[model samples]
Target: MADLLDRRQRLAAALCLAAIDLPANAVAAGRQLMQAASVCPGVTMDEIPTNSRREALTKARDILNELISEASAP
Candidate 1:
């Protein structure tokens, strides 16, 4: 339970970092998230924001959306 929560946090942090255009230790963070997720198979990527700070989560979402939008632009 606690481990699963930790992984969710790690994923949120990693995505937040990526969204902000910052270089992140994503491989390690992803490993933690994956391990935690494996233990709790029902987990979804959406859980990341649900388990983090509201302000941070909002920023992460906005940044991620922008990043995706930018990437998809031709």
Candidate 2:
């Protein structure tokens, strides 16, 4: 479970970085970020061991919030 979440977080970070690196004219970059951002809430909602749940949810929410802020940034 931890491995899965770690992979997902890494993938999300990579997507966000990719989006940031894209040319201003690349609409698909924003789409990619949005796609990654979309998964975060679901990740937060996923059932996990009680001991890990809060930390997982918090991380997911933080990533989601950061993605949102990045998307809205000029």
Candidate 3:
């Protein structure tokens, strides 16, 4: 969906903001980014119901925000 893709893009941009300074936990941050990027279902999983997909995206966004905050911390 366009909305999900847009949110994904926004989240990716936010994640890149952390890379600007290259945080001490760069590897962890990279991992989190990968997790955040995996909004779609995996090979083992069946197609996600529409509502479940929306919920997953929301959870990913929340995780992205936490990563951004941690990256911004002094």
Candidate 4:
């Protein structure tokens, strides 16, 4: 489960990187930072709710966040 969550987070970070046109190395660095800080979920969903060509990616981010957050609930 944790591995799956991590993969989803990485995918979200990749989307963000593409949206902002970050270089590949920087994208990996950003993904690592977010994963370490455990804020990957929010960071990933940051651009969601804004309709655009990247809407699919944004939605994926939002869905990933929803899943992780729900799982974290007691």
Candidate 5:
């Protein structure tokens, strides 16, 4: 269960990166978002402010990194 949750978090990070317009990957991101929306009926996307996206990405990255480092600790 923990592994599955971790994978989801990783996916979130990837989605956020793609949403942030990481060059050359916009198409991939668009496809992913569409797939997600399909699975999650009625789940829609909103055009949030740039700063909000940056903040979310930063917080998610920090949490993911901390969890990974803890799992790797001796």
Candidate 6:
């Protein structure tokens, strides 16, 4: 069960990186984010400025989606 959970977390991180179209040779910051996500599957931007936890999560998701779209554009 632990192995399965680990695999799922890794998969989630990989998917997030891929969605952002971040290559393996991406910047250090991007790599760091991927590494962090791999370990914390439920990562949130609560530490960031926001009125509420839900707002922070929504902001984070929107930012990620924007990055993905921008990266995917040719």
Whose TM-score is greatest here? 5
Q: What is the lDDT of residue 56 in candidate 6?
A: 38
Q: How does candidate 6 score on lDDT?
A: 0.48
Off by over 4 Å in 3: 1-51
lDDT string for model 5 (1-74, tens) is: 33445544554554354345334366775785666544433443542223444654765577678887988999
Output the TM-score of candidate 4.
Answer: 0.35
Write candidate 2's Cα lDDT for 17-38 as tens digits: 3334323445765565456556
Query: What 10-residue stretch in candidate 1 is worst by lDDT?
Result: 15-24
What TM-score does each of the candidates earn?
0.34, 0.34, 0.33, 0.35, 0.37, 0.34
Alpha-carbon RMSD to native, per candidate = 12.6, 14.4, 15.3, 9.0, 6.1, 14.2
Worst 10 residues of 6 by lDDT: 15-24
lDDT of 6 by residue, 1-74 (tens): 34544433343443444343223345764665556566656664443322343443454576666666876999
lDDT to native, each model: 0.52, 0.48, 0.44, 0.53, 0.52, 0.48
TM-score of model 3 vs. true structure: 0.33
Error of 3 at 48 (Å): 9.7
Clashes of each: 0, 0, 0, 0, 0, 0
Ranking by lDDT: 4, 5, 1, 6, 2, 3
User: Mind giving the per-residue lDDT tens digits that candidate 4 earns over 9-41?
Assistant: 655554554443323467675564455336344
Clashing residue pairs for model 4: none
Q: What residue runs in model 2 are displaced by over 4 Å at the alpha carbon?
A: 1-51
Stretches of candidate 5 above 4 Å error? 1-3, 6-51
lDDT of 1 by residue, 1-74 (tens): 35534444444455444232223366765665666455545656654442444544585566566656876999
Q: Candidate 5 lDDT (Cα, whole model)?
A: 0.52
lDDT of 6 at 50: 27
In model 2, state the lDDT of residue 31: 64
